[model samples]
Target: MHRAPRKKRRWPKILGFTLLGVVILGILAVVFSVQLNNGLRSATGKDTPVDTAVKSQLVRGIEAKKTGDASHDALIDKAAETLQQTPMKTITEAAGNQQKAAELVSQTTGVPEASAQVVTQAIFNDSKFDGVRKAMANGDWVQVYQQGKTLSSDPDIQALTRLVQ
Candidate 1:
């Protein structure tokens, strides 16, 4: 007796193509984000007058933050400036010795060594700061943060305030 013809399976092929399409879209999104970020950096670069022009055209909503005291704001700004200037390599190398790191942070930010240790540890191994490290791996953390009237979602600048407290 002759056997009936078997039906072709299409679900596997359809599923694979759908997955491939999703992956392609995801990659495209990542590339687009990177490109946009790079463009933003060039536009806002410190070395150029473009930054001033661009900033001037935009509405400035974020004023300098004050912790209700002049001395406190000064302390916070000092710590922020220290973190803003320090490179990732310096931070990582200093982290190799917790004491050294704390000393460096204390000297740079003018905070007490004990407070510096806390800030240094947070920068070195805290899970909460992992995102900040990744964003600032290139050492130019300015990309991931904003100071003065700029807006930033990165917790790094905020985290530095812990040093003063």
Candidate 2:
């Protein structure tokens, strides 16, 4: 007697499963790469960590202000006020902090005297400016990070981002 006909396996099911596996693996790889990239960025003074650090500091300052930490709060307020003042006054003060870097950013970014003054003043207000200034002078990653942090915390940066977009 002839053997019963062997069942013909459906090619579609096999292909579908293989395609599904490939898609899943692709997604997983992308996620892993993103995570690895983030880790590397944090270690190398990249923008992400700088932005996060600045944002955290800003939030802490707000909390301090809310809790009535008068000195710290006042410092923040004074910095904000300075930025709103005339550009020459602001730039003059910033030049005392990091003359070269401040000058570079102002020139390279093509910021107007007024806006550059405010921006540089906001940068100098951050207590970390000394380290940042050194890094800026050397054109190091640290300076890039510090600049990113400064820009992230500055209200002017957000405003500029909005304007450019």
The TM-score values for the models, in the order shown, are 0.36, 0.26
Estimate, for each residue in 1-165, the C-alpha lDDT of model 2 and write its tens digit. Answer: 789999998998999999999999999866565454345554664445433454455445545443366775666565444333323323323445655436645664566666766777766776655555544333244444667687668787678756843
10 residues in a row with least lDDT, candidate 1: 54-63
**How many pairs of residues collide in each model?**
0, 0
TM-score of 2: 0.26
Q: Summarize candidate 1's per-residue lDDT along 1-165 as a digit string, tens digits.
A: 999999999999999999999999989866575454435655654322333333333212212455568887766566555555553345534645667778877878678988998877876776655544544433233443433223234467657655535
In model 2, pairs of residues that clash are: none
Global lDDT scores for all candidate models: 0.55, 0.55
